[model samples]
Target: MSAHVLIPTTSNLPAPRPAPDRSGTPTPGRPNRERGSSPHEGERLRPLSRGQVEDRRQELGDLYAEVSGGGPWAWNEARADFLRHLASDARRPGFSLLIAETTVLTGCAYGFPLIGAGPWRADFGGHVREGLLRRVAPGRLFVVSAIVVPPRVRRENQDRAWNLARRLQRRLLADDGAALGVTLVEARNDGIAETLRSWGWRSAGDGTLTAVPPGSCRVLVLTAGT
Candidate 1:
């Protein structure tokens, strides 16, 4: 969930994928983060409040479907329910959302604290197994839920793109002095993991999560690491 969406574009080249260390733990390193997606010309991003996201749920779902490369009606089939729940959670006290603006919703992401009793705590086996349960506390662990950046506005200006991401991350996290930031990505999407690592994140562990599709996920834990 580093809420980091490592968009794969034709311009991106293949790189080595990270593997678990000898101890079978997620290996941490400055893995090369491949670049592909960026904001197209005349496009900009703005931090959106939970209310804004709820108002634009349909748009977000459509963008998500397109970015996901899903078939027609994928929005209704796959994204509708997910967005509903995400928005609902955003309405809660501690949840947050981020949306990119380009005359419409170009990209978006949302997350919440992992501390206390919440959806994230539905299954804490992954945290317990990794000895991370003790670290979960309000203002401590932030769980990035989902990040979507449609292919429409990708690969525009490298610097601008970086700025957009930085802004979004900044908004998602207030300088609340959280000790660790956590995100879960599908096993197949290791590019996100690598990019998080490049951003001072490391492989914390791997586990099954009840996310959009309920599948295998690798936890990318952000800390003062390579």
Candidate 2:
């Protein structure tokens, strides 16, 4: 495991909070909400090194369970699957993890650069033109594997949650200097698919490209500066 690295918070976002207390609790402070300030002003966003991610696996799993919203068995299964993916993804070249928090972990997003032509490309089923792929440079394409934000946050202030999600995605892409970002959303998950579309992601293809059951998911893409 490499030493953890913390990316400096962007100037447009809120400044970092005072150091946490010995108990690891964030100090109480008012959010800076000047005009043009980020809606996520009260939260801090930081990138986690692979080492840091391994250290926080349990905490991340719990957060995933909470966000997934299921009974005990389902939660357990979801957490396990999340852990498995995290382990595999962490080893990929240029893997990056960004987490948001205030008093506790509120959300997380992670991904790795898409390097070379892999089996996953076949999943696109030719929807992603070869010429387009060459133009973007596969190495410059980042795949956002997951974005997990608790439901309560969305329930209380959906706009804030939306901004947070966007911040996480953009930061990840910026960190890698990626030209394009890609993610897949289940076709049945209309809420998330709609959210991604509203955020300027265009659908490139459907699950027929990748799913055992056609139409199970949709592929969405966001080019840099879009």
Candidate 3:
């Protein structure tokens, strides 16, 4: 993990929180070329809206559970609540959820803009910059709440999971003009943080956490603009 953790210190500065705590990663069959399949082979993509989130809420929850390593109850609760809010126009109007399904539910990338102060501030541990608060207000920042890929996908083709993730991020960049992107990753888990680094996510080196099983989370940032 990075040295600049998000925990509040004497400096009274808080770095980014663990990505909603807990975790995820992905694999699959193939979506077909007409679907403009993945760079590898048969893998198509589908972009969803808040409305779909409302409709597939249960399925979404199940997917997260199937892939994520268990965490503290509080961390789990916060994660659930965050997804609930994103399903509404809660963060409006820049949230995103993309699912990649082939023979099965391969993976997903989901998020919402971190704008305008609200109860959400408490989720990140109240020590962020006024500038960040201002920048995230509505359009300046986007927070990735979840990223998941089923074990089947991971077992069959590891690269495919990342391919789906990259596609999802690309779509987000195409749709949201936000300057920055943020997401949480397990700091000491099995190489998840390292994989993200290869994908261009920069760690803050701070041990900020949003989930329990204490000291296992850290946030990563990506300047998503082309």
Candidate 4:
């Protein structure tokens, strides 16, 4: 087991909050992509519209069915509950969720591309080390969690996960102007530490976590100044 320790601290500032319109729809025009271009391209990260989220969720359902044959992924029930909570969070101020999809692959059923202005409740206190402070400031875009589902779990699938995580990190970090801290959470061990490293994510020196009862569950946190 690894010991938990607090990251360093730099400064304290008021956190920024997201805005909203009561209609439960994104204001007026289409949702903004940070780059002013299509999503697959290097577009800016913006809050996904309600319709877009539903569509992405449906796609995830399809992917789950195809891959698991209707069985659940490691902890499918809990993951499903998390997705519902994300939808509710989107309705509140200072919270936004974005979903990025591609025909080539699918991500976690509950996991979207990233969350914006996410309430990053750091259990380990901090000035984050690992050379990220210079990249992002406080109250930009904070990614509370992220999930990546490989094409398959075999040895060959390692490359797929690595490529997917790298693309996600790039897209999320492209618009640092409206971003803060990006924290990516994934199943630990299982040959993923190297994949995250390949994507330029350091350990953050925040230690690691394990699921209760010693199941095939572990969690690692990675941060990048966004």
Say which candidate scores most in TM-score.
Answer: 2
**Ten residues in a row with the worst lDDT in model 1?**
16-25
The true-structure Cα RMSD of candidate 2 reads 10.0
Q: How many backbone clashes does candidate 4 have?
A: 11
Q: Using Cα atoms with residue i matched to residue i, what is each candidate's TM-score against the true structure?
A: 0.59, 0.70, 0.55, 0.45
RMSD of 1: 10.7
TM-score of 2: 0.70
Per-residue lDDT tens digits for candidate 3, residues 1-226, read 1112111111222222234311222215533332233333445668777777678777766555445434456346534744554455334446677877767665677666765556654554343434544554456567665556543332223334245455566556556666777765544542555444544566543433334255555667666742
Predicted structure 2: lDDT? 0.64
lDDT of 3 at 22: 17
**Model 3: residue 174 alpha-carbon error in angstroms:** 2.7
**Per-residue lDDT of model 2, residues 1-226, tens digit only:** 1111111112111232233232212346844342244454677889998889999999998887666654677668767877877887788788899999999998898988878565555664344556556768658988888777644332233334246666677788988999998876654455565555655577764422333245455667877754
Report the CA-based lDDT of candidate 4 relative to the real structure. Answer: 0.37
Model 2, residue 193: displacement in angstroms? 1.6
Highest lDDT against the true fold, candidate: 2
Distance (Å) between predicted and true CA of 224, model 3? 0.9
Task: Give residue 113's lDDT in candidate 2 (0 to 100).
Answer: 82
Write candidate 4's Cα lDDT for 1-226 as tens digits.
1211111001111111222331123346755332233223322234455666666665544443343332344235433544555555445444434344454444431222222333433321232343544454544434434333332221122233234344454444444334433443333343444444444544544443333233222333345431
**How many backbone collisions does model 1 have?**
5
